[model samples]
Target: MSETAARAGWVEITCEGELREVVGGPNRHAAHKTRTALHALDRAWLAHSPLCFIATSDGDGSCDVSPKGDPPGFVKVLDDTTLAIPDRPGNKRVDGFTNILRNPRVGLAFLLPGRGDTLRVNGRARIVRQAPFLDGMTVRGHRPALALVVEVEEVFHHCAKAFLRSGTWDPDTWAPQALPSRARIAKALDRPDDTLEFLEEYYGPGYAERLYG
Candidate 1:
């Protein structure tokens, strides 16, 4: 549809008051659940989370979200108000790191497989090139060259309503073949010059062996 036709009948919310009027206010617990420091429960949650999504925005307001994962407890809890996430092998885009250089503010969502609830953290972050704590973050004999350290500003546990509604953890609802395979998609969108056989071999079982290499 044309821009004007697509926007037709759309009512924009201009202020917090107007938005709140439509969604209503939170209850006392929801309003007061945010904490400036990590509680024991929060620390425990971080210990068991193997994956997290980090959100960052550059000075120009360009945003990026990157997933960081490893064995459970890969994220280190330095203190009640600090956390350190080790950098791992990846595509080398470093979009999130580039954004952090321009803006230190970041938001993180930690999740555990098969669990619906998640832990949310918002804070100012800094890239640490080297630290004594980095020694303890080693995994599979590979130590990270850098880590992202965050100073806690807000911490809270998010409800599982969204996950439950989508049946995210229910194996019965999974449809892995619903879309084209990764190799096919990559060939069509990113690696058109490569053969499908080569792409499939590149993404096959051996792919997991290169995680820390």
Candidate 2:
């Protein structure tokens, strides 16, 4: 230990709450949040976004972030302040969806490839299965297992730094081809071929026609 530096109190934390916006440069005028800024169902954002990440945590604070991707507008805007996202088939852990059952607090980050700005939605969610909503979506004639209904708390657009840092829009930065395919992934799990192939194919086209139609 550096006794001299420790005695000087160099590592001091004020622990004060503050809003810092250093990256966007100094604001001559502070812009307070407005209804326009806090959009519920902005068609433009949904139209551009084909992917989003959903973050949820359980009562114990254990967390899961699931990557959700489909055609643009796959997430249906039920009203000015609510969104209906179909619970598509997957590996069946249902971690994120289940977490929301215990704790409604959730964070959604909507992403559009090749675009700089992205939509961020923070909200509380509830699971629902009903007539209009249930009838609104289907998968290969089969209906959605369930749907997550999100009550918008706050919504905003963030700059491109996240995409730039992740190189999400760059084809060269993509994951290597040797990464496991669904068939290969399923093989590793020892699941049957019929189920795996159906799921693999269902993930894209099946998903589009199912939810977006």
Candidate 3:
């Protein structure tokens, strides 16, 4: 078969009607759960959340999703319609931040350990390098150099079906050793020039000491 002919065997739904026909529409409560500003319950959830994933896309629609995490309550609730997430030490790629500069729209999903549900927020984001709030975001005497402030446009509580189906919080379902260790993978793919022994040492127990440095 020709390449185009072979691809014709796959069926794709390109319109809302076709897509909805397959999955069905959400019920009234599911369809109307979104809120434009944070509620008291939402604030409580954010206070207890230690991690979240931020999703962004550049002007050209190129995308990136990055994870941000810290001790519980790391994300600050600035107001009913605003939130601030501290930027911590990481690989320095800043792919999401770059995308935010090009396109302010962003989405976030906040997760709590052992919880099946998540809090979702969609908003406009701006990168702030200097702010009085940055001082209060400090941890272990290390203050963040920047933060991403989000003006919440929509916020909602997502259902836990995805997590429940995946057994995410079930300890018995975990198999972390099913894959190679971080050091071994880094040596194999990212740092081919470095010796395996060196990479292992670099990602060893002492690695935690450099987390704030």
lDDT against the true structure, each candidate: 0.96, 0.75, 0.96
> Candidate 2 residues 1-213, lDDT tens each?
688966896654453432233244445332433232345345678866878899999989999999987667778887777877877766689899789889999998887779877787888999886648766666456577688888888776677887789888798988877687765676567666557666578564556555533
Error of 2 at 62 (Å): 1.2
Top-TM-score candidate index: 1
Worst 10 residues of 1 by lDDT: 88-97
| Backbone clashes, each candidate | 0, 0, 0
How do the residues 53-165 of candidate 3 rate in per-residue lDDT, one tens digit apiece? Answer: 99999999999999999999999999999999999999999999999999999999999998999999999999999999999999988999999999999999998999999
Clashing pairs in 2: none
Q: Which stretches of candidate 1 lie over 4 Å from their true place?
A: none
Which residue segments of model 2 deviate by more than 4 Å? Answer: 1-41, 178-213
Q: Model 1: how far is 14 from its true place, Å?
A: 1.9
Show the colliding residue pairs in model 1.
none
State the lDDT of candidate 1 residue by residue for 1-213, as single tens digits.
999998999999999999999999999999999999999999999999999999999999999999999999999999999999999989889999999999999999999999999999999999999899999999989999999999999999999999999999999999999999999999999999999999999999999998999
TM per candidate comes to 0.97, 0.69, 0.96
